[model samples]
Target chain A: MLESYIEQLQRVETLGELNDQVVALRDTLDVEHVVYHSVNSTGEQYAALTYSPEWVQRYLDEDYTRIDPVVQACYRRFHPIDWKRLDWTNKNVRNFHGEAIDSGIGNQGFSVPIRGPSGQFALFTVSGNASDDKWASYTQEHVRDLLLVSHFVNQKALELERGTDQVQTVSLSPRETDALTMLAMSYNRAQAADSLSISEHTLRVYIESARFKLTAMNTTHAVARALSQGLLII
Target chain B: MLRYIYADDLHRFPRLARSMFVDRAKQFHDRLRWDVTLRDDGTERDDYDDANPLYVIWEDTTGGHGGSMRFLPTTGDTMVNDHFLHLTDGVEIKSPFIWECTRFCLAPGAPAQVSAALMLGGMELGLNNHLSHSVGVFDARMVRIYARLGWGPTILGTAGQGRDATSVGLWAFEPELRPRLLSRAGITDEMSRHWYDRSFGALTPTAKPALSA
Candidate 1:
């Protein structure tokens, strides 16, 4: 069932379709809610959630992210976090939790934090009303599936945001390729130059030209782009 | 020196154990800002620590943690299997020949060689135990560190992107790679062997003599 939902998710093209799919996914999983919230590096926020429009609007109008323990905690985490583990000692936090529950946001939650290129931060969450033991068993049984779905959903969201489903290809000269590969292998400029039998100045030229071709911000960015785009095997 | 201490024996080196956990809190919670639980005593520990996992520790001159890493066999509960399966495409890494390594931490003022030395200790653990590979999940920032150590893992899969990218990788333990690791750690083969001998007894005659002094 999860696999079919992921298949349907992959076929979704527009953000609206993605939102509908999220709702359908929540129903299929028999959960109260499933949410995918992304905040890009440019500070643009996007979300596909099963929450009611009124509640979502109220959440935004009240700027709840400033006080949402889930958001605050997930921002610093790189793994799935059980809601029970969060600190709710602060009065404001307690009130926020109370309000969330009152708004039918469920009493149990699991959030997975994802960080993408250029400071893109996103959270994938599942929430439902359940006893603590039941919630623990549910999360344990479905953690892997949730994790897989989260990343793929986020990847699709990023792809749509870029307005391109196609992979971008950039060509590089042999020397440029060699330079990036050496750098990817953690070789310093001097060592790369010595290994390639080229002067350090010449290696720098190759790297600069490659960086320009890839339109990367820096050497590290260039290498990362090259690797991600399949331009460099290493 | 590299000491392979299990939880059962951790009490024997109380100072080293305490310092190791304290440094873990400093690195994972304070420095990295990871959402890890910090005890009131300021130590970062989790369920895995209770599993009696083995720890490879680099004891500094003052008998404190210089650098350390935790290892648990893939056959048991591991960080990769429990938390980061998304990076592995939901495939659990369970094998007798592969162990999981995590919680890599370094003291704030540790020397540059400490990281490499820790890697050397990991290699020693794998080779001594007849394990073929060690699996780990690390962020992109660690890529250069692994490469500089002359032993990079074969990336199984990666998630996210750029600086925040996290990957699950498998590193093969080949006898041929020992010398490069030794040079990178700046430790003589004899010294490495001595440390290994301290943890486990001297290498058997059937085992490769390269690590034997």
Candidate 2:
């Protein structure tokens, strides 16, 4: 099933195609739901999933992001994290969960956190109804494949973003290329810090410095420019 | 030992945030379908980080921030109280003594003792702040983790799905439970099974209220 998901990922060459393919993958997965979401280097994002429009809108309108433990925790790490490992011990977060379940998004989920040059990030998650034993076994079975697909999709999406871009820019330093590539590769600050053998503070300085040179507002935007402007390769 | 770093002090420590996949962290992007990057100027600022206490646990020798947690004292501006309006419902919340714990994280690949250190740090920070009782909504699965650390169910709490779709419960790690915990340190899991099989639990130590100016 995941092999076919990868096949679909490979066939898609455009962001629109990827979006449609993502939805198709969800339908194919035939579990309950599948979602591919991204915060691109431009900070413009795309979310293609099977979540009810009501839940999606309510979540956005209510700004549940700040209170969401899964989103909050995933942002802080580099690995593809399960929704279960997150801390959900707050009252509002619980309310958010109740609302999500009511929307038919299910309780069991696996999220693949992805990164692209210029701070591009995307999380592809599949949520469904299953026993703990079953879900654990399922995730264990497919974790590696999903991780690869996540990065592949994000890379393609970045390339897609580049194809549609109207902007242009100069070359990036090797360190800058490495930095954006790490961010592109979904290296969270700590892992990215270690990968670079630099302090996270210094990494931020490097990132912000890159942002300044690129005339970008933030790291995501910086990454977007790097990709769209051909400053960094995926 | 625990070294607390404010988000601002993310400058001094350097390792935690920098080592993090910069764009992937909460400030840049969230893993869910939704992206919550700051719109005002593309900065990430939750309510608690500014007004409530935000702490990052650091290794004193290496200065690596191994874990972090956010604390919101029971107050009007706090999200644990204000934002979570639906859950509180008609329940009574005795003000000024409770704290809402949020975003507790362990630095990836830290030593096993790190969580224990974080607990000690949290208690000390709470005691010094004049807070007495503490409340945390927990994922039902990790009830064992909290139970092992020192918290216990004070209430069943509101019926709700957890952040992860797991069952959840409300718990309290009150100061009054300290002696019973320490005196029973060597107790077997059988004896400790007052409610569940969790091995770790915090015995709330003596309450030391902060002196008023």
Candidate 3:
């Protein structure tokens, strides 16, 4: 069944077709909802969801995005995360949770955070109501499939939004590449500087330069981008 | 010793679970002033608990529960999705390998090391079960605790102030990382002897009897 879903997803060449595939995938999983949301580096956004239109409207009307922990957490992560791990301790958040449950949004959620071309950030999530053990087995059973589907969805979305592949190759100077590689290898600045026979300040310059080139959010982000893009070898 | 407990098996340690619940009522309701509903029995039970969460408990020699925490799969009922979904800006996370940890509690007067011991046990459980991550919403103050314990969790969400300020994060546990974290935290001593085993379901397994020792 998932094989068919993947084939259908691969065949989708447009956003409208992709939305239908997302809904079909959601039904195949037998979950309450499946959502694919993305924000490109340019700040343009797209979303495909199986949530009720009423709840979606309410979410927008209430401006809940500012306080949504899942979105906040996903922004910081580079891998998939479970919703149960997020912090929901505030009173307002607890109230919002109660209202969501009342609105039939399901209580369980898992999201895979995707980092796409040009710093595009996307998330794929599936939510439902089930026992912890049952949910555990279900997610365990389907995580790989879900991950594949997420990437496929993001790739299609990226293609549609950009109208061309945006994976431009980036070039880094030898020093900048070495700095990023050392940082990626878990080397502290002082150690990296010592290894490279450069001052910490010089190392920072290379790192900052590399970060700017990659448009990374920080030094770690810069390192990640370098590694993911094959611009630096560990 | 660190023992895993499930909600169904909670009945086995009636006194201990009840004590922990009362402690939670005091810690969250009274001390933290969290806006959680409390039962007339002075226990704090919520819908998530009803979902049969996996729990890790640390017990001292006097048959008392010293410290404990709760676990739930992200694929099921979790606080972050139902209530704090707004915090994620509508991102939903459902993963089998990621579980949620919550209701971390330490009985009054227990040694500080007990908290670290409880966490170590939880890490062991995840590692043994091949679980990749343990996720939770914690007080912003606990960030220091994670750093001190060398859990090295990635903060997924920024700290937010909503009465009780909290941060969401996940700790990735690889088998190789466990010993490193233990040594970094300087936790060389083994955990206490009593554990409540609920990870395997109703058939409880007790640690080796220690009378000979």
Tens digit per residue, CA lDDT, model 1, B1-213: 889787767999999999999999998788766668999998999988876678999999889999999987654467886888666544455443467888888999999788889999989887755565787877657877888888887665677765456677777778888888888889999999898776644422211112212
TM-scores for chain A over all candidates: 0.69, 0.66, 0.68
Score every model by TM-score: 0.46, 0.41, 0.46
TM-score of 2: 0.41
- Per-residue alpha-carbon lDDT of candidate 2 for residues A1-234, written as tens digits (9 for 90 to 100): 655565466556666788787777666555588888888656797777778888899989999889976677455233355666665557677677777777788777777655343345677788887777777778776664555455556656665777745333444556657778899878888898789775554455446446544544357767876787677766
Which structure is stronger by TM-score: 2 or 3?
3
- Maximum-lDDT candidate: 1
lDDT of 2 at B159: 42
Q: Which ten residues in a row have the lowest lDDT in candidate 3 chain A?
A: A76-85
Measured against the true two-chain complex, the DockQ scores of the candidates, in the order shown, are 0.02, 0.03, 0.02
Model 2 chain B scores worst on lDDT over the 10 consecutive residues at: B195-204
Task: Tell me the whole-model lDDT of each prediction, alpha carbons only.
Answer: 0.76, 0.54, 0.69
Q: Model 3 over residues A109-208: C-alpha lDDT tens digits?
A: 7788765543567889998877666677788887766765676677678767866355445677677788889999999999998998866644664575
Measured with C-alpha atoms, the lDDT of residue B178 in candidate 1 is 85
Off by over 4 Å in 3: A1-234, B158-163, B181-213
* lDDT minimum window of 10 residues, candidate 1 chain A: A72-81
